[model samples]
Target: MNTNSTIRARRIADDIDALAGITEPDRPYTRRAFTPKFLEGRKWLEQAMRDAGAVTQIDAAGNLIGTIRGAHPDLGTIMLGSHSDTVPDGGRFDGIAGVIAALEVVRALRDQGTVLDHTLEVADFLAEEVSIFGVSCIGSRGMSGSRPPEWLQRVAGELTLEQAIADVGGHPLHSAERDDIKAFLELHIEQGPVLQNEKIDIGVVTAIAGITRIEIIVEGRADHAGTTPMGARKDALTTAAWIALGVEELAKALASGEAHFAATVGEFEMTPNAANVVPARVRMLIDARAERREDMERFVDELDNGVGAIAAKTGVAVSAPRMVSDNLPTPGDADLLDVLDGACQTAGASHRRMASGAGHDTAWMARITKAAMIFVPCVDGRSHAPDELATAEDIALGAAVLLDAVMALDTKLQEDI
Candidate 1:
């Protein structure tokens, strides 16, 4: 990395470290979308963007867009950004780190008075977590023209995504789409220990996983635990438990060398939830994932087959109330990958090319723009919890690489356009 780049990145990293109190519990920020805490963070970020000399706007989807104008007005803009709203009790470094790092990039650019030919933007996407709307990529999906109107309106009550956007001064359904913006780049923590475990400082994410969510209900006769004979009673909870383990094993068996497949039963509900009564019905939420679309399909098939078998054997009825599937596997842009790889080498950071098991907003935005992501290591594959962490040195190293990549693109747009 250039001497100037190193100096600039260190300064940026210091500023973010100082903003540590933005969220509590020190490690996980706990700033859910549309909450008062998120509002405060958004206000501070807006001021930061303005102070960096970027023209800022809140889009209809409640996405905060900060732009630095270029000499050429007609060239589409280059977006450097990520979401700030996090999962409940999520790590401070997960999404906030990226937003602040991009802010610092623009800060460095403006402070140095460097002018590029294409406009640059930093976005703080809203409602990335399934809060108030049960939708994951609300901001990016809405901006990309992928969010259905019915889904937005028919999905909920007062906490509709439309209302959330309106609360933030955005009219997504009525606003005209911006014709500019050529590509997008996002910097984020890896959220997994692979890079750290492998002693790599950076990861050029190859693809985002495709996720399938299923809500299963198992129904059996509720009876008095004291009087019902074990052989005569049908236990819904027991049947559901059997299906969950069976699905887990099936996923492991079907996982190929090239495909990463996983099945998890994250939530379980037993009617009455009492120790004395036999559960009449049990509800389970299954989350299955894969990096390949075909692999994900197979996983879902196996899940249904296993659940059916369990129901038949246990004399219980199984049904699915809802199945919501979104986010396809998004491969990173090849040109962006080359630029990022070169940046990592120039910055003298060790990097590995890998596919992300978790989803991010870029997975949705890639459908509309050329997009790729940069990842730094998480200490122990811990995230969405208070214990998630990354060292300052690693954060600084990742930021330096991000600065190099953005600078390269900023200059490349000048010559290409």
Candidate 2:
């Protein structure tokens, strides 16, 4: 399996270079969705698709799609892609690599003079990164029919999201759901050190972890910091500190056995401005993520029970954990995962199964189709920053794996779909 030869590392490098140049000159890789820079990047992707012999169009959701007709157009489509837009200073390869790699697969197929049975589509999903519209996965959510209609009215500057969609060649009011996608595949950089540290070539994503944010408030009587005895006065700040420590201990225990669990006291606030005054109140927000529903449930239960004891011991009133936000985990399709595992083997790539700690467009796409994603290694698992890195050689290998998966899906789905 000569992956470098098949995927054409030079084309991949050139595509990255071209798109990397369309960023804000000062920011050096910033291309927020609905911005001019983002649109320019999209235009480049559209033309690249055309050069690969794909018929291109923008969906109502503003997803840029490039389709190459297959031997049997009546059959369902095999979709491969990732987003192209970036966060301010977000590195060059967050979602861009996947899009370019998908394009390369199509070009590689043409080079081999092979035609698939199912039509292939390469997508550059709009705003996979949070955009000026203040929401992420805008294109994917809209495409899957999960995007709230109210979100269409979300405002950014003088334009509503609906207007912005139009500016980018989308028909927001005429939003449509995709029913013909036989399977969807997204190739992304791991954006973490596991792949690189372990010397793995690919990560077969098992699931996209769900995130839940909980707010906990700690209240205590205000007293003079200098006069109040350590045992006599209840300090909200001290109580909050204890709770934060408890959160860490519990999270560490949960993380130990390993189904991708993490909890952080990400937000904290204290009342009273004076340095001499004891904190009258403290508020904390916990950002917890779990790959399995049961793991989250257990973590919440343990935390809730621990909170009562903590407040009792501290003599400070601690409110129950209030869930400010909660979203369930999205598991990859088993059949699709099997296909990816087979793809890795066929491509001569070393890989492992893992769960994504971050959210992705694939999670939304899963709502409507048998969708899954793969991760290639990035330097230090860094992303959403200027220093994030993934080599062209590594990306090409990932593309080869994706190409293999596409071929498998094309043949495998013919009987099922």
Collision count for each candidate, in order:
1, 2
In TM-score terms, which candidate is top?
Answer: 2
Which tens-of-lDDT digit does each residue in 62-137 have in candidate 1? 8998988887757778888787776767647777777877887787677677777778889988777777677677
- Candidate 2 structure quality by residue, lDDT tens digits, 1-417: 453446898999999989999999889789889999888889888999999999999999999999999899889788999999988987599999999999999999999888999999999998988788878898999889988899989998889999999999999998568998889999999988999999999999999999998999999989999999988998999899999999999999989986999999999999984799999999999999999999899989999999999999999999999999888999999999999999999999999999998899999999999999999999998988899889998999999999999988888997674
Best by lDDT: 2
The lDDT values for all models are 0.78, 0.92
Clashing pairs in 2: 191-381, 192-381
- True lDDT of residue 200, candidate 2: 95
